[model samples]
Target: MLDLERRLRGSKQRLLFIALASVCILIVLLNIGVLSDAPGIKSTIIKVPLRGDRPYDTIPFPTSDGSDFEGSYQPEDAHPIAGLMKEADEKWRKYEESRSKTFRETVAKYREKHGRHPPPGFKEWYKFARERNVHNIDDFEQIMDDLRPFWAIDPKVIRKMAAKLQENPDDGIAGIHIRDNKVVNLTNPSWRSETLAGLISRFVKYLPDMDIAVNRLDQSRVVVPFEDLQELLATEQGSRKMKSDARDGFTKNMGHFLNFEEPTGDWDNETNPEWFPYPGRQYMDIAKLACPPESPARNENLTVEDADALYKHQLGGLVTNFNLSTDLCTVGPAIQDQHGFLYSASSMIASKRLVPVFSECKVNVNNDILFPANMYILKDPRYVYDKTYDYEWEDKADTLIWRGVTSGGVQVEDNWQRMHRQRLVMLTNSTLMSDQEVKILTESFEEKGKYENFSHFEPSVFAKKHFDVGFTDAWGCIPGDCPFYKDIWTFKEAVTLSEQFKDKFLVDVDGHSFSGRWRAFLFSKSLGIKATIFREWHDSRLFAWRHFIPLDNRYDDLYSIMTYLIGTGFKTNPADNYANNNNVYVRKHDFEGKMIAMQGRNWAQRVLRDEDIEIYMLRLLLEYGRIIDDNRDEIGYSGDGSELDDFDKKHPMPESPPHLNWNTI
Candidate 1:
């Protein structure tokens, strides 16, 4: 009987050992993301050794909770954002393959694209592209998108319009004059004109003497009506008639680029002056005129209350197609009140008239030519990442950070809360000083396995642990409206750019225009979570989800995106040692987040270098030269491969400025 008892005791000890081993393995798997995290993944069975036949036995385990709230957020396994990395990788691969590697290949591709011989100075531009290692030579389609429309109008008429717009401070347009292989004049005394002249002076030697008008306001200038744009596009298409003898190289233009001639007329810069200072009047009174009759901006009418609901439905819980979401024509006209750029943009000098005007950025509703913003070109210290604070992904705090002013628009009493910057601060600051509960996706309580559930978290505590977001000040609101913003919200002291570099993820939302600090954020090692409706010059070079994370302008997806990256912090769960214990396991995505961060950081260095900008400008100038030339049809580049060898000997590039100081400009 004693021997029998000993045998039973020994068997019990073995079973206990097995049980302890299984628990340890489970913890390891859960922490490593092997057990959960991805959508449609994470197993529900544990293998145990069997006494008979098979070496192991499969023990059934509970899956995620099948509750309503659990299904709403990012669940364990099979989430939409899980596949974004692979998608971005494949897209980048395809984009690289699409671009021409050799100069001859670029020339060959251009003929197929434009159906004509290369433009004048095309050979010199190619050499510059090769020397500078420009990532994008073939994709200057934005220049085409803006310049193509002007092809429908008489070149002389376009030139006249350009002259009238230039040197007009009331029009908020700056004139840049390039002559004798140098920049000679920059009309308008704004710093923008000076900085632009400095940017153009880098390669003015390769460019034909030309007049360029740049819009100085944060708002876009041209808003071509939909019917007019369609007709213009058709005419532009006809202008690119393919030449049978079109081949390699370029031909010098017999006709010279003419000086901008002012048209004889009284110019009215402020035709609609009374509309000023009214929030959302730009979209209602002006921008929607660009949308087609069938488009939602023109067709669908919704009150402010209905707009949010409809916008969310139209935009899914997460953003998959960043480009498609920014289509102003697709969304309801209610965006007029929702977006600051649409509502209270600095557009006192906005025009429905089509002109060859350049801007830093514009929405799909505007037709302004896009150029690289000087804010990026200048690289101010305030916007630059502090190298002293930069850390590796594993070493960095797993938090998302954002800091900015309330400068989206001039906020009034009624509409201050609707501005994107204000809304972002409020949402991120939820529950911090109050009992407000915000929904967060974290491991479930009472669940046997690791599964994310849409759980409620105390705002102050939760946001403090995961997010460092707030405004430095409330700057753009009207006098009466401004004081309350300070009262209701806690204004945190502004943190430097380098301070944000310590975090794993950084949020970048639009200001009055594209964020001046975008280039700096991209330069950092952290994930750049960008949310904007405005389109910039380098949109074609980078892929969303791969290089950076894209958020909807509505900001509904902000929390979900954050959860997918750093994870919801520890919460009370049944799996803990005891009930109500705050020891729930949450998934951290360092590997995934770092993968995207490195991809963006590396690609930014590759394609968005200062040299790359100069290369893009040179190519664009060559195209612009062709567009404005009187002998546009006859002017072409016909250089063979031999010219590339003797490029410098044939046409020497001008020496760049020794130093460019932004503060002085």
Candidate 2:
């Protein structure tokens, strides 16, 4: 009887264990989207997105054959052209008249229909309409004037001037137009418009040119390529000596506004460079504290809405990463060392001088990190597309495409940011990827040449456990010859062989610091899938879905998210079809997705042009000039510096002071 009781007790224990194990398995399955319908859930199994375009559909993805784009703006402020400001003012007046008339008619119609005029701010109801549909007077004149400076003599006028010059090329100083019998035949002329507004606008355009010329001249004076600066940065004593020299005259020359002092901390590995007036950790903590309540760091397992929220916060929170100062140019918090010397880089805020770089937990700065237009499009300007892509929607492959180097991941001892690259490799090699939605071209960590230094990377370790990942050959420089540049370091070569960018979807992930090809992706006219944890100069201007799809940095969510997007008409209709795994059986055309792509392309083409770059650089120079001009007295420079004379000796007015009493003007 006792033996029988023991057997019964053991059987009961075994039954309980089985029940618990089944429950746990069910929970795991649900979390992994085996049964969950929660949006953007990852499927344990991988598959391709539904192809909505027809085989013979002639819907060409709007493209251009790389003509009509122009190069950098040339310096042409030799002479000011006439009537530009007057022309601009007259244009504004006409627009105001037309708009006022239309607004009056609208108000009358609204009163008749609703018994009251439209609420306040009705005229400004559509803010984007003016920027999108109608170019403002200022914008129109700026572009036109820059492209064809009014001072550029007409072809007929040029011929007359040439004829006069030929009569006596060396002796004759004949003016293009008769001016009081005086030749006034100088190569560089003065501004023609007398209006203060016009004069300022015209003067501002040339400041950038002058700034560039001066910088070039200064660069020539340096003995070696950043040699002195490099040595100073490498050692503490050299840095201190350089600081002492700056205090002697150069600091005063720039109108030293703040008192100088030596840094009060050990120059350790954890500290920022001496040029930065404070430690990096201080500002980094401030950024974290200033994170808005809606930041994604507040929660996990986020949805698309959460991602959008994070993007907005990042766009606005850039200011929190710097020290507080009413003066925009203040470099950092002050120290109390009166004997210390002042240097511009030390006195100017780091963010103002350089864009911040993120490699794992550390932050660095790089001023040379401009958009790749200079390196790529400048090399072959004809390659720029007037529209977006070079293929039709139906002809383009539906796969998600990416190609880059395995850079940061291998340097685990130095950089933690490389995990994103590793995660990408794993997704491409997943055994469950029967449809192969993701097509990546990159060297594997085990590759013999480039990534041989990297340690072993198992896809399953970085990705979901059920992926059943497999090994794939490292595609180190297989296709050969980068179409972009000669010295293509990463990817070993351009991975344009598969025509990957021409694919329906493009993935842009961060490299060592930031994604260099993000702007290209923005203008690609493909569904841009951006996955990063860094903020760029264009952050505030970007909008998710309207601009590009924002993917989480963790990258695990990409597979599930892409599945959701392609299956649900790119989220236009989230309920179009429901599936247990990443596969979608139902195929529906995603017209809205195409529209989003077009919008993104249009925005990039409009704002990221060479003309736009010129304008940005010009504005920055103007601001710096203003600061220097404001403190000219303390700087002890007469208006006779050779550099000033080179740029027409046109000194910018003080930006601040004396509240401009009307009578003073």
Model 1: per-residue Cα lDDT over 578-613, one tens digit each:
122244344555545775676677667777888877
Each candidate's TM vs. the true structure?
0.77, 0.38
lDDT of each: 0.66, 0.32
Query: What lDDT, from 0 to 1, does candidate 2 have?
Result: 0.32
Output the worst ten-in-a-row residue range by lDDT, candidate 1: 62-71
> Cα lDDT of model 1 overall?
0.66
lDDT of 2 by residue, 1-665 (tens): 99999999999999999999999898777766744556766445422224433311223323332121122211111111111212322333453343321323433443343222222222332121222332211222221112121112222222222222212222211112111222223221112111111222422423311111011000001111123323323442221111111111112132211111322233233222223222212232222222323333222344534443322222111111111111111211221010011111111122221111111111111222222123222423333433334454444555566666543222222221224554564455444333334311112224311211111222221123222222122221213221222221223234452355567777776544455567766777576777554434344344554556655444544544343334322223434322222122222224434544665676666555544444433333332232223221132111111332322223221121101011111
- Native-structure RMSD, model 2: 25.6
| Candidate 2 ranges with C-alpha deviation above 4 Å | 1-205, 208-389, 413-418, 432-494, 568-589, 631-665
